[model samples]
Target: MPRSTFHRILSPLLLWRLRHINDRVYLILMSVLVGLAAGLAAVLLKTSVHGAQQLLYSWVPEEKRVFALFLYPIIGVALTVLFTRYFLGGTLSRGIGPVIYNIARQNSIVPRSKMYSQLVTSFLTVTFGGSAGLEAPISVTGSALGSNLARILRVSRRERRLLVGCGAAAGVAAIFNSPIAGVLFAVEVVLSELSAPFFIPLLISSATATVVSKGLYEGQPFVLITNSWPVQAIPFYVMLGLGTALLSVYMLRVYFRADDFFERWPGTFRKVVLGGLALGLLVFLFPPLYGEGYNIVQALLAGKPEQLTDSSIFSVYRDENVWILLLVATASMLLKVFATCITVGAGGNGGMFGSSLFTGALGGFVFARLINLSGLYPISEVHFIVLGMAGTLAGVVHAPLTAIFLIAEITGGYALFVPLMLVTSSSYLISRYFEPYSVYTRKLVQKGVIVHADRDRGLFAQLDPLSMVQTDFMPIHPESTLGDLVTVFRHSTRSIFPVVDAEQQLVGLVTVDTIRDALFDDEHYNTIRVADLMAPPPAIIEPGDSLLDTLGSMDQHGAWALPVVNKGKYVGFILKSAILAGYRRQLLKESE
Candidate 1:
């Protein structure tokens, strides 16, 4: 062979071999990078929001301290209006739907356009005075980093999906300094798949991110919880869990409804501008709702429980104003829901996790007050606050394990595990029973994406590929002429046919549509070979491969049907319909 010919073959072969060996390693390294980036982004975004708020406060005269409080929302609304209008294509963005869509369909490539939009919008949402949190941007940034990195390395579609999860896990782990929680959140909330193939990478990425985050922030827990409450709180925890679950479902519904209503507006920018104006006015009246509510949480934890009140238009002071806090917390909870819906529904970019936490805290406070009235051992309201946080999150995300672990990690204690687990589990179970979907899955389902998993493993194990194989499949040979192909396909019952060489080596695939298209061309009247019309080798599946994996591959490719080849020889085929019917059959059998 000539040198050029030899080199061409050799280059691809070497690259392919090297890629096969190095892809996993590259994913691991990128995971670490995502973790670090997410950690830094969270910290910087948080600081910028606070610093801006402080600077705004300073600009006002000391006599205008209370006036400045209302001004906080004005600042947030103005900046958010500018950013959302100019940067986000004038649409309110929400959660990780775009990221998930890209991962599932577009190979996880997030445009820098959307990436920056989320970063700025989320910052303004929380910092400028929106009743949301930074967690949305953190997850988006992490997924974007992984997607961009994976694209650079030319990773496979499956690996790209895994990387999205890894990056998300890393972001969560770093933000909360809870590796296990991060991993579980990735598995349970993000991927929504529990599989051996994904666990290792998710775990490693989360652990790495947590370590990296700790290095930068000195390993402080996110919530700074210190408690030695007795185990008697389990029953109350259950109540808290169930209550939070019901409340989360209600909030999610309202949020989506608000989003729908806003989107129905005649114009995009007008709706957003109007929403911003409304938010400005509301925050102007009730200024403490201006940010992520972290400062509010701190105040509550410091024993100023009296700050909660029934008024709708007062500032959230750092001092414990129980009545004020009650009013603000309840109003804040409702307003946060609406703000999130408007922010995303109006095309402002951001996430819901942060809002969920804030809502949980509010719900917890309410629950605690109710319990206190019942003469329960005066458990600190802060304790109820923590439970409410986890319970609500668990219901919203539908990930009890992740929720419980996150609470423990965020609070820096396993001491509350009894209550945490009880509440989280109950909330998750209740939410799932009512809706049968998490926020992520609901978005995916809306987009017509199917989430396939190995839930019915025993059915798969018992199934024989041959049993599901189509009895009659169209076939063609390399030597077959155009006329021969036409003749065979004309009488064929099947829509598709597998083409093979004389030696029966798997060659290509052709369909009746191809034959018809060819007939419209002058080439069909000549002696063109069957190989000429056939596609390149089809996606072949071996006998030993799991049926679930085969099904996933077919679904991933949207293949109408796939050829099953054994040792390069055509064996059988499986239709998509059969797979679906088989799934139904298995479900019936299990029910029986």
Candidate 2:
């Protein structure tokens, strides 16, 4: 055989050998492969974003760069949406939403195309200053990698989900080189479970991925280190925590509203034009709002606030007064949300993680400076800036462990663990007060798409009325007499008889119980039509109705079976027994 053909023919044989190996060994081996793949992907994406930034950020004259920042976001959005729509077929959604959704709906199987779609779109998005982070895209890609791999190997759904968690952990770990944070994020946010089976694979994956990412970078540059602060500043950190919580609510409110508006904007062409133009205009006025805004965090930690303000529209007022600095930082936090909303709402790819980090940094800067100005105590703004990142991340994601460890691992060491825990806990508690769901789960909760967390709920979500619809129920026309319904019941043991219109659309449901009173009075049975004996179906189900809603309808009517209708046409019946079986099956699967 030719060399290329020989390898191709040998690959599946190797996979077969690996497949029959000890299950534990096979899992560990596959996790290593997934970790390497995810790590490499994470590194390449970072490099690509940097590369694009280097080219775009260098476009303007050194003295006049602010003037050019506006053009890039629009350019990035247009090209991204254009390529996603016309060239890439369609873009995979970024972040934890799609990952969780796929796990629940598709047996943890993601399409093969997601592996690169996120990489390409997110690179373009964050590169051209699309005010979002690459974490979401990385998360999407990593989950896809694991899912597709599992599918290729024909793993069980449970094992497939485990691999997906491994991929997610590896992706996060690879980017920040924080294995512990990566594992926490996988459990707290992506997998939404802290089971023992998941812990081993996730830990191994994150550690291996960290090694790969660390080796590839040689010396990673984004490690966030800061100066030490006094223990008495815990009170100050407490206030900062509260501020982050409030900011979290503000951002989530703004984000979902923008999401709703842009959802109605329609068509890829319009989203690119309007969303891109809006983001561009925002960036033009607020130069620091460009891209992921990690540069701003670095500037704050280094006590170089001038670097951030130097290019903003407020540059003329830069650092002239402490109040001016506070005002600018505060305004930047608010505008960062606006720019991010435009970036994501307008169909751009990215996550809220970057924006939350930037916003927290600003909050911390404002807090530190204001306290210093009071002449009461001089707290280290760097400490506050670093703590602020964790606090805001905790509030936004409602995953305090992930936030705390991520900040601790990246910020040199855990010397500030006390303050970190205090701030993260407070932020998470306060944010969870009014807004119970995190950014990823908010839409899912509203749409009832978040059925995976609860066994009963997940089972309900898995049972499609269409799939459960039993077509054996005998249906009669409205014009048919009760005698016809009698014949239906005699031939069929089912208690529910559906009366349809001339076109075979359900008009009403006649139960055996209701007609029993009239059946014995048979003198008028021939004269009475099926419609006369029928009650409005106690439970009527439609083909794409939410499973929870369908269950609610059934419960409300005290029905064991509901007639399924699609656009007024009778489809079939979904029995309560089928739903029971679905719950049993899902519960068994989970236990196994």
Candidate 3:
């Protein structure tokens, strides 16, 4: 069936049912459904990636697993690029930026295919050592589910955006099994607001998703346990917070530098192949940077600093160097940033969530080890590891609340909550002072985009000038008579007609207001021409004019509508009625 034919048949049924159901009730119900689906997606993605990683790595001998891990990243990332370019049009993005962009510009409507695309692509990327996280990709998949369902259901734009947020919250909760962090993440990153109406729905969605996740997967306390912080550790915690804040700054800079490096690669194939090679070199040398590096994090928390020490390529080459382990631990922070940037910039997939976790673990371990080496106050490396995760996350994501709650929830205790808050708050403030936007939103804020949440500029930015144009206006030749213009008006309901030359160039406009006397005088019928009765328009709208500027022109001329011109040809009339309606709708949504 044709799209027009489909819409013709589907629209009435949608509107009929839409009117019957209370919108609030419908949204609450949809939020639960969206949460279930998003939770399922997260579970599926996690299982798929774990399966693929196991299957691929199982083929390698255990003795050479470290060495062979280097090649896996290259193969996984390059194959992802090939599949994307050849089969998926290379348009599938594995990040939250596009989600934000859509909500801002496209009214929260996403392509239906995005519901699965990120899952497939990100699974391939992370499973084979893309050094990226699945959390962002899963959120994107859930967001698509919510957005496309809204498109199918023909929901209002405002409601659609909220559904998208619910989906994101569900994805995050399901992945981490932390509903509070999930809601906070949705508010800080996706929704960009904390409206009361959006809160209950987002909370319910996240809680539901967490329940689904726990129902399917046995919930394990996230960690290797360690002793609680000592009273003497307070000063050390403050110093570590300052250190993590500085490391966070360095990590952010390193990420963009790596992205810039990969972006400059000339050819698509060269980009993928070369980027993979660089990542492979890092993995070959460091070994622990091979995947998400979670096993290494586990090792660090378990008091086996020897795990990273042995895997350090520096140790492999320069044996018995006491400082080599600490050097490698510090270097992993920078190398992980590079590997992650290469993964995404070279067209692999995944996000900063996993990368930050790995880097923070390294930073924490390094800090404690250095402190002990200095013969100062001793700190538990395990406890510091948790703090490091929150601190780095707070800086990289610019959401201190999310970072704090994530650590607190996952640990199932507030034993580390005080330090977590201290580090995260300091890191977030410092990061904001230096780099205001998170990795996800840097480009968006710089470009002045909207998230359907901006009240002043976003509303106007979203209303496309071309979409508001009424193009059905009839054009009368300038040399034609007033009788000719009258005949044109008889068949058309519009009061305004453009006077065009032989080439259809708009020369003047004739309105019912200006031709009242001519219409009453039938005696001067053929004696008058369109050119005599038509007047030069007080204002004209060009195709590229913004809503604010265009509306300002109309206001200045005291006109309700204006003729649209593109290049030198007449297009149509852009009515203040349409512009005002769009503005009012956006205003109400923003205020809500």
- In the order shown, what is each candidate's alpha-carbon RMSD? 11.8, 3.0, 6.4
Q: TM-score for all predictions?
A: 0.71, 0.91, 0.79
Report how far residue 220 has shifted in candidate 3, in Å: 3.8
Give a tens-digit lDDT track for model 3, residues 466-565: 8899989999899999888888889999998899999879999999988988898999988988888889989878876777888899999999999999
lDDT of 3 at 397: 83
| Regions of model 2 farther than 4 Å from truth | 1-20, 218-229, 316-318, 477-479, 501-508, 513-523, 535-558, 565-571, 588-592
In candidate 2, how many Å is residue 73 off?
Answer: 1.5
Instruction: Please write out the lDDT profile of model 1 over residues 321-344, one tens digit for every residue.
Output: 555556666777767777666555
Q: Rank the candidates by TM-score, best first.
A: 2, 3, 1
True-vs-predicted CA distance for residue 453, candidate 2, Å: 2.7
Q: What number of backbone clashes does candidate 2 have, counting pairs of residues 3 or more apart or in separate chains?
A: 0
Candidate 2: residue pairs that collide: none
